[model samples]
Target: MLIDFLEFMISASNDSYIFLAGISAVIGAILPLSTIIFANFYEKSTVQTNDLYWELKREVNNSKAFIEGFNKIIYLGDNREIFNSTLKLFKLISYILILLWVLVGVGYIANVSKKPLDSFIISCSTLALISLLIYLPRILSRFQRELPIKVENKSCSINEIYNIFDVKGKGEDKLFYEEILVPTLSIVNTNSKLFIRYNQNLPLNNYKVFYSIQNKNKERLFINIGLLIKNKDFKNIHYTIGNEVSNTDTVQNKFSSIPFGIISKFNEIDSKNSFIYILDSLNQILYTGEVKCIFNSETKISKYTIKTYIDKSPNGHISKLLQNNEKEVHLLDDQQKLTPYYLLDYN
Candidate 1:
């Protein structure tokens, strides 16, 4: 009886091993095929993303060219419509592509070969979700575009102003005037060497400052003042100013000092308000301030400007200030004021 029981146990063990081997063989075959399918889907999604990206780029270049040609401002409205539409589509597609790849990774971890029917259902559901996401944004963007948007040319008053100067001669015969926009109203003496410390809370590192001068005739001149970058330690910020002649042109006279008046006409704009427009690389205005000349006995010695701009636009803080508007918008609570210190005193 003991010999018969042992023989029965051995047969059961052999049957179990055979069943396990069959399962493994099925899994091994299914996994490779599933992997190939996922890989193909990933490759297609990547190709679609690349194609959309290039299309978006082409649209941007066309819009830029239209603006540079000084075409009617109405054409700009049309370009914006196209740009927003393309951008929304591009974003949605990119997000769905990422999600699809993540789903493929999850399938491998979840042992999807064991449940082929469930895996197929999941893939179909993912594709449906991607389609829905891509379609919804288009429908919404179109609806929004068709709706009339009343954009008010709102003007805001400056909460604080800072007077910064670099004086060489006594009072009137100063050759150059440099204006530095700080968050705080700290008095900087040109005679003494001081380290200008920016407020850490101020979003200067993300923006590029442009010195804009408009003459009495309303002709505007824009200068790329400088951009503030974080130091290696990320504790302090440094200013890097350069003048770009054109898209393909480069100048050798890259100086650290903010060139207030490279053109003599820039100094002659005493009758009009000189504006310091803070913008990102995309030409979106983040802040706007007026540069007022301080005349001492009919000699323009110093200049001062307000430190903030209107935060009305959706993409940026401010768009533009209405000319001669009495309505005043207050400064945002989150805006930080800058403080300047002596360079030797900085730790």
Candidate 2:
């Protein structure tokens, strides 16, 4: 089709307008495809980053849940490796393709234009240079994030959170459950004196804390702050738990211009405590359940977050998920632990 178009364009060869038309046609075809490919590149980066972030987040959260089980989670390093590899692929392929695009733009201009060979070379060279200038940063932009920290055989365990909620289980069930808990969650407010609202039952006496921001008239926002929990006997685990995973279903902020989608519960903390999520979006333990942190590597700072997949209720053939994989956990850690919560802290 490109060739036919090019031929038709060349047939209409009027030195005055042929070059311009050819440039337009070539750009018309290539731009759309390039846009789509670039979008895929962005998507690949996001998906890959989320995989890594959640894995680490889960591992750290689980270890903190129970002090004793931290040792068990260190080995589940599977998804960490997978995400690293996927990210590498995304970077390598993206840069090369972008460079190829510049090359093609230069080549197309040279082929279709009837200018003197010297003039064509000069014009194409300039165009290629411009194209390179535009895409080189694109190739470089993704490199800004440092690669994930290696699981350096050191970790913190909150065995308390793991024991608090039964967050791990079989196969895709666990992963799927986590899908709801985890989100493309990001901190929206960079500067705001904020605090985490806990469900009162959270018993942590020492740890860092933060929470998302809510305004009566704006879209919900996430904010992360660090606070130390030094009072271990504070028995309001329910409030703390609820605070950690509660979907924002309170005072509707009608003062803003942005839309808050479905109560805006995309943010999830990668901890062992099963959050009391009322996926009112679904309604049905299949209705609401806790996010139990199962296991995280005790020996590594790198995470292996896993969850105890649940079916809550008879939502359909959800029960058959366990029978689907090597019998459980589609994505895994280095030690072969399945996702939903980090693995090995299973006390």
Candidate 3:
């Protein structure tokens, strides 16, 4: 009986087979097209606010609204269990319809001709369609990933300096100094080797040294100096900070030898002022030395330095020198040996 039915299908008229295949193809095409249209509508209905903070707050406050709206669009107000069941049923129906379409298309092609050219064309078309279906999601995801992120334009100014550094007033009455910790994490961008030297032995309590700030996870937060210092702050303190090694001949990479330093403050009082050590890299530090304020009466400039060896440990921790007279002398000798190291000098 099955063989007789197969024989009847093979001997059937091309017109009848073509009509059946066309109808099946149209119905199969419409189901997926309607699915796409409904999927787009579902996407539009679930559009989220651009601000992540506000969007999360809104969701937390009115979580049910999202669920209800999503259900109304995707499942026609049905619960998740019912929606899932219906989805499985629809998928099964789609698969069945696709199988039927392929079977009908093959039957129509067979009825029309027994030629190799016709079979080759049908096979190529089916393979191409399958390939398109397989890769369509990946292509769409790639398109979304390549979209540019929107960022608000921030105008650069000197006031931004206050935002970068933690400023505090120290002292009382007639004389006072502003103690600031300019976070080296944000400002150090150059590949240059930064050296902080204590030109004179003043006091360790007065000056700020290069330090690292880590989060709860113990990860360092990195920031671009170019973005932070694109204003008057760069111009005002550019001379005080050196980004070049003195002896350029010994340095193979000239750009990498550019010295970098941070200016602590600009003040009229010579005795009260101090310089903060800005490192070339966030990980680098002044291992051992005391920073001192040496006010040049003639030059009217305050010079601050940490006469020390800058070294990194295996565990990513900076080694600190024992604060004593002997270590201080050793640090001075080390600084003298390190000829091309930069200093923090300000007028």
Which candidate ranks first by TM-score, i.e. highest?
3
lDDT of 3: 0.32
lDDT of 1: 0.35
lDDT digits (tens) for residues 1-347 of candidate 1: 99875444333333443454465357435643443444444344444433443343344324344223211222222333444545454455446454543444344325433577766765675566566545644543442332111111111011101111222122221111122224321212232222222222112233444444445444444333333332112123333223322244333343223223322233345333455555443455545555553323343332334433422232222233222111111121212221111112234
Q: TM-score order of candidates, best first?
A: 3, 1, 2
lDDT of 3 by residue, 81-184 (tens): 23234345446654654454455556666766578988788767755654554454333222121101111121123222222223322212001111221122
Give the lDDT of residue 199 in candidate 3. 22
Best by lDDT: 1
TM-score of each: 0.24, 0.21, 0.27
Q: Compared with the true structure, what per-residue lDDT tens digits does model 2 show for residues 1-347?
A: 99976664434323523454465457546644554455455455545644644454555445333222222232222233344454455446545544544445445555555567755675666566456545644654453343232222222222323332444232332332244223111112112211122222222322322222222332222222121333233222211001121134232321112212212232333433322222211111222233322212342111112233434442222222222221111122234333221101011
Q: Which has the higher lDDT value, candidate number 1 or candidate number 2?
A: 1
